[model samples]
Target: MKIILSNASSDPIYIQIVNQIRQSILSGELRAGDSLPSIRQLAKDLQVSVITTKRAYEELEKEKLIDSVVGKGCFVSGANKDFIREQRMTRLEEKMVEIIRESKELSMSKQDVLDYLNLLYEEEHTP
Candidate 1:
C-alpha cells in the first residue's frame, strides 16, 4: 500500500489516509483479505502520528471496507457490488447537483452542459 501526504491540503491527515485506502480498495489495487500494514508500521512509514493512522483504520472499519482481527491486523473486506454501486451513484449525484448549480449560475443551457459532458466523457474514454 502507498499513501502520499500533502501539507497544502485543507483535509486532515487521517482523512487523506482514509480516502487513499478507500480508493485503493475500490480500484482493486487492494483485494479482499489483503492484509494492511499495522497501525504503528503505517504511521512510521507515513511519518505521521500513530493516532492518525488508527483513526483512519477506525473509519475504514466503520465503513465496512475493512475488518480488524485481534492479533492479526486489518484486512480488506469482501466486495459488496450493490453497496459499492450505490455509494458511487450517491457521490455522482452530489457532484452532478453541484455542476447543475454552477451551469445555471453561468447561464449555460441544458444542451450546452450536455455537450460539454459528452466531450469530456469521450475524451476520457478515447486513447
Candidate 2:
C-alpha cells in the first residue's frame, strides 16, 4: 500500500493515513489478508510519529477494514466486497441528495449539475 501525506490538508495526519489505506482496500489495491508494515516501520518510512500510524491503524480496525494479530502486525480484513460497495453507495446517495437540495436552493438545474460533474470527471480522468 502506498500512502502520501500532505501538510496542506485540513485533516489530521492520522486521518490522512486512514483515508488512503481505506481507499486502497476498497479499490482492491490492497487485497484481503495483505500484510501491512508494522506501525514502527510505517512511521519510520513516512517520517511521522508512531502514534500517528497507530491511531490510523486503530481507526481502520474499528471499521473492520483491517485486523491486528498479536505479534503478527496488521493485515487487511476479509470483508465482503458487496457490503463495502453498498455502504459506499449509500454514503454517495446521501451526499448527492444534499447536493441536489443545495443546487435547487441556488436555482441550479439538473443540466447544470450534470455539466459540472462531467467536467470534473473529465478533469480527474485526463492524462
Candidate 3:
C-alpha cells in the first residue's frame, strides 16, 4: 500500500488516508479478503500518528468497506454491487455539491461550469 502525505492539502491526514484506501478498494487494487496492515504498522509506514491511522480504519469500518476479525487484521469487505454503487453515488453527490458551492462563490455561470466539466470528462475519457 502506498500513501502520500500532503502538508499543503486542505484535507486532514486521516481523511486523505481514508479516501485513498477507499479508492484502492473500489479500483480492485485492494480486493475483498485482502488484509490491510495493522494500525501501528501503517502508522509507522506512513510516518503518521497511530491515532490518525486508527481513525482512518475506523471510518472505513463505519462505511462497511472493510471488516476486522478478532486476532486477525482488517480486510476489505465483500460488498454487494448495488450497495457499492449507492455508496459511490452518495459520495459523488456530496462532492458535486461542494463543487457547485465553489462555483457559485466564484460567480461562474452554470453553462461555464458545465462546459468545463464536459471538457474534463472528454480529457479523462479519451484515449
List where candidate 1 sits over 4 angstroms from the true fold: 95-127
List the candidates' TM-scores in order: 0.73, 0.82, 0.80
Prediction 2 TM-score vs. true: 0.82
Where does candidate 2 stray beyond 4 Å? none
- What does the lDDT come to for candidate 2? 0.94
lDDT (Cα atoms) of all candidates against the true structure: 0.94, 0.94, 0.92
Per residue, candidate 3 scores C-alpha lDDT tens digits across 82-125 of 79769889989999999999999999999999999999999999
Q: Compose the digit string of candidate 2's lDDT tens values, residues 41-91.
A: 999999999999999999999878999999999999998888777877897
C-alpha lDDT (0 to 100) for residue 10 of candidate 3: 100
lDDT of 3 at 68: 88
Predicted structure with the largest lDDT when compared to the true one: 1
* N/CA/C clash count, model 1: 0
Ranking by lDDT: 1, 2, 3
**Which of the predicted structures, 1 or 3, would earn the higher TM-score when compared with the native?**
3
Please rank every candidate by TM-score, starting with the best: 2, 3, 1
